[model samples]
Target chain A: MWLTSKIKQLLMVMKPGVVTLNYPHERPPVPANLRGQPVFDHQKCIGCGGCSDHCPARCILVRDVCQELRVMLYDGSRCTYCGRCADICPEQAITMSNSFEIACDQKEDITTRMELFMMTCQRCGRCYEMEKTNAIDRINLKGFRYDNLEQRALIRKTSETFDPTLLQQSDQYQRPSTKE
Target chain B: MSKRKELEAKLIARLRDDVVCVEKTDPRTIFIDVKRAGIREASKIITNAGARYLCSVGYDNIERDGTLGMIHTFALDDSDQFVCCRTSAPENDAIIESITPDLPSAGWSEREVTDLLGLRFAGHPKPKKLVLADDWPDGIYPLRKDVPHNLVPKGAEDVAYELDEAPPGTKIVPVGPFHPSLHEPEHFAVYVDGETIKGCDYRGFMTHRGIEKLCTTQISYNEVPFIAERICGICGSVHATAFSQAVESAAGLVIPRRAEFIRTMMLEFERIHSNLLWLGVAGHLIGFDTVFMQAWRVREQIMWLCERLTGNRKTYGMILVGGVRRDITPEIADDIRRVMKTIEDDLAIIHRAIEKDTSIHKRTKGVGTITKQQALDWSLVGPVARARGVDIDARRDHPYAAYDEMKFEVPVLDSCDVWATLVIRVIETFEAIKIVRQCLEKMPGGEFFVEMKDSIPAQRHAITVVEAPRGESVHYVITGEDNRPERWRVRAPTFPNLQAVPLMLLDEQFGDFPIIMGSIDPCFSCTDRVAVVDLQTGQASSISKAELDALSRQQQARHASLKG
Candidate 1:
């Protein structure tokens, strides 16, 4: 009777098809929209410091390292993952990734870094970043499909050091769709 | 005039000129400012006329009004109107008449104002230190404007939390400050004589995070919603939505219809996860492992679905001030329908298995009971009030969000026991599924957000309520200068329900303590910053047992004469 009772209890545990997962050997399926650690595209980042200012956790930091250098530091462990930073970003450079297996033994492994170069204002001589503002204006005036016409106007109007090839290739500088 | 207007008219007639002024913010709210001397009488008049006492909010308005401010909030369940009684006392001579002598449920709210704002309520029955830690020094109220938020004074060690005196032969058995049965740190001193519990006392608020002061002093208006979402882990969206709704009401802003539907959908989604979590916790407290495992296995899929909708499973930071951050697309609506169907199927199996079990019936039925009259006297809410045949739901009575358009019934059982509380939760889960489907089907198309360019003007007070899974969560927001609320008071449903636990523990088996306390689904962090500290410890006198019996007899004879 004791052996039969034990066997009966074991069968009942399997009613929900296996309760525990063999986590290391076989992974569970995560949804596509799961908010993991944030990923930053350095080419599109403007170093405007909006993400650092609006972050509730203060996980993102933008510090002026020198006359022409700005450093952005992010600590993933302190992040509440509320997505305020990504929403407030001027350029859509920061997006939440689907890689949620972010466990680490070392504290330094949780921190990420990005560096940017600054430009000077023509009138005030104050150091600033002009790449994103100019791009936004361009996206408003010229659509993304007009690469040939915009590049010729771009070289004539601005410095030759400014490159339009990467801007055209990425094809990311576009105004919001007319939905609202 | 409507019945609601008649109630207000009666109060104004009784107090006449003592009611300094009466203002109506909307058709649903009546704001009355009465003389400081007539507050107790006004409260008595309102309670006798069938208005449920909500909670009180206290703030420092010394600079603006030259006195401290206090507002007592009330709601009429039958007519769906909220009434506010505003009064203030001089800062130098800050004393007000107590209402706890008649309205027993207003005890904790009065005590909270006592310690936090330092306002003394005359004739308060058993006043003692609450909310602040035992080792905390006196004369330093955190909510006062003068005190800095980061001030951490050195605390005195070995300060004991004075418990009430043991009743005659019953010894005091302390249960927590942390226990396996209680998920948080709270102390319950149960006075038991052999196998029966004679009396009990509680000391909680160990989870106060000091976020209330931080939000008012440091954070801006846009960031306060994110902080409000962290008030309670299980009911995060409820707090966020309630705070945002209060702000929107104060500023007179209207959101799009689609945003309201999305907000309703998320609130119902939280109801599903929270109710399932409570079921698993209840089963674990009763020493049944199978029910706990099966309930959690069914809950895992809903967590993944929440992650799909809002990116994070638990916090789900989708709600903004006037609207939601993201819209629910057609594809996402279909996905939600599939996940909800699976939950409905799995829940039915667990419900059938537990409903017929003899052990569950024996353990829960006829245990931890409070009468219908006592439930009303204590002003209990949510499922705890519904189980006792008191039909009051914030969603149905005071309809906010898309609940006015959705059709669902408030499930009530008159059993008035732990068993009834469990059954009511199971029935409400199905109602949640039905409401979500209706919201998705009738969702309207419009702009997702209304960007307000005007700054929110100061000194507007709004009271908003949301029916969380456990009970009604009420937030009183008073807008202020510099874009933050001057005072934001949160009265979670656990605050009133937990206060009535001692009444339910009268003359019960000592083994039923955990289930009785868990019946309220207590969340200490939400009702943070104070406790009902019992101070009648054995130091009253070193009197003998025979002398105590004689003194008690004399007191009873005097009380009987007074009542007659």
Candidate 2:
């Protein structure tokens, strides 16, 4: 009986392969709705600094060119891969990416920064257009009657003057970039 | 509400007015701040009041104002109420008096504090670098607040610390920061003679990450959860959970019920896997190959369950500030339940075999005994303390998430030996099963995450502690006006339990050193960056238990060589 029992135990060990996962060769199923690093939607970003303010790691950087506050920048190097920035975005402008293979030799490879263009005003010098692509398209797109290449040129030229100090004094002077 | 309250009340009366800062933080644990001058007298008063020395000293640099805060904490008997004695020292030249004479466990914690914070503990019997490598510079204390947030030091700078071998009569054996036996990177300089271990110096490379400074200067609040979860590979869930809780608390946001249930489930799943991992490690340490194989096999079930549920093996990234990322469908829940049932059956076999196994008994029984007195003095936490019959489970004592509603028992073993710790862990695995089941059954229906529309409230500070697999994991957050936390402190369980290793290993046999030290399921040194120092005299001369055993074996081999 002892010999038979020993034989049975040994047989049991060999009868079936242990349920080992042959990973890399056979990929396991990744569940849907996996939260990874944040992916930026440059067009929808408002440069509101919400994601940067709400970001735990302070990885988000926002640079405003249109004064209408269109573009936001993010450095992925400092990002903790926390999905809070995506969850907190009011415009639903950010989503978490599954591409977490962020190992890089250079620090610059890890940083992620983005810029969004601002909406120019139709009648006034002020920029107020947001979420109205038609109005922005009619004003800035080349084919439209109200199209103004000058406004786009001015927006491009004076973007460097969108510094916090310059943004505060925009209405104080009639001109933005030019001394005249 | 029991003897603990009575003793605490009696002790509080005798303590000097300015000497103690008493406040009740958690239900079971008391947070008492003792002045620097009263460390000796206060410890005596505490001992007379039936309190034991839990651990010795470390510093929390409150701000970059360039003052390093030195803190020594003590614990009362049969209670989680710990007293912290603190004093301010110079950031540039951090020095403080050592309390190792009062409590032996302070010996290691002080060495760690000395290594990381550059605090010179005067009168410490064996003050040496316990965490940072030998080549680390003298003045670059990683934990100091004033450390320029961006400063990464020149590589391979030698530390100013000098290593002296334990007094000549003692035999010294050195273990590893990279030993195959230990699950994490920790080194021990053990001194032994004959069959007895005289003393030990617990060392590691912990302070390398510059994590705290990085959190303040580089990473924002939303990004901190993922960085914090990387603090420990095994207990990543709780690290993320606790960090999120701190941030949410600072923002004055209460996560929804469904989110809480999901968090609870993730935490319990983490607990199951962590405990099973330790089971396999402990089995391997005792040379029980069958047990190791079987335990790891069972652990694979938990890991698979985690992967199926969370989509990652070690770093499960499901946690958010207000809620978790993924939700378990009913089908997924049923599948998990089925897998857990299979694991539960296997654990029963492991428990029985561990209890009855002769080799395990010989290896673990009556070895590395930490008496209740010693445990209390050392202020140990998690299963290490529970094995010694101290009932302080942060989940139960301080209810967080779905833990308050879950029904489970806290395993306590008064034996305070390696065997008792294993038993406690095995029993707790069953309890963790109970917790997971309760969470699954009672999981409420609601939104998975709440969208935070409003800006974060300014200057609000909040702290949270979660029961990580090893022990209480704490996250303290001080939010900036920009809605991110200005300062975040994540204290893992091993931060306290690692202090108790010297006490556990003292007077034990050199042969039994590994298993005894392994008794405390230590995680890695905190998210600190690494600096290596090479001592001219002590490079490989520092002794290890295995080295001593090798010496004895060498003698035998020489005798055979001579005869042959």
- Per-residue lDDT for A27-123 in model 1, tens only? 9777677777788889988666556645655567544434456566777867887878777666788898888788887646877788777553321
The DockQ assigned to candidate 1 is 0.10
Backbone clashes in model 2: 42
After TM-score superposition, the amount by which residue B10's alpha carbon in candidate 2 deviates from its true location, in angstroms, is 7.1
lDDT of 2: 0.64
- Best by TM-score, which number? 1
- Give the docking tier of candidate 1: incorrect
Tens digit per residue, CA lDDT, model 2, B47-149:
6665544444344555655666655544443444445445666655666667777777567667767766677877888766666657555667665555655
Summarize candidate 1's per-residue lDDT along B418-497 as a digit string, tens digits. Answer: 99999999899899999999998999999776666567888898999999999998899988876678888888899889
Can you give the lDDT of residue A153 in candidate 1?
14
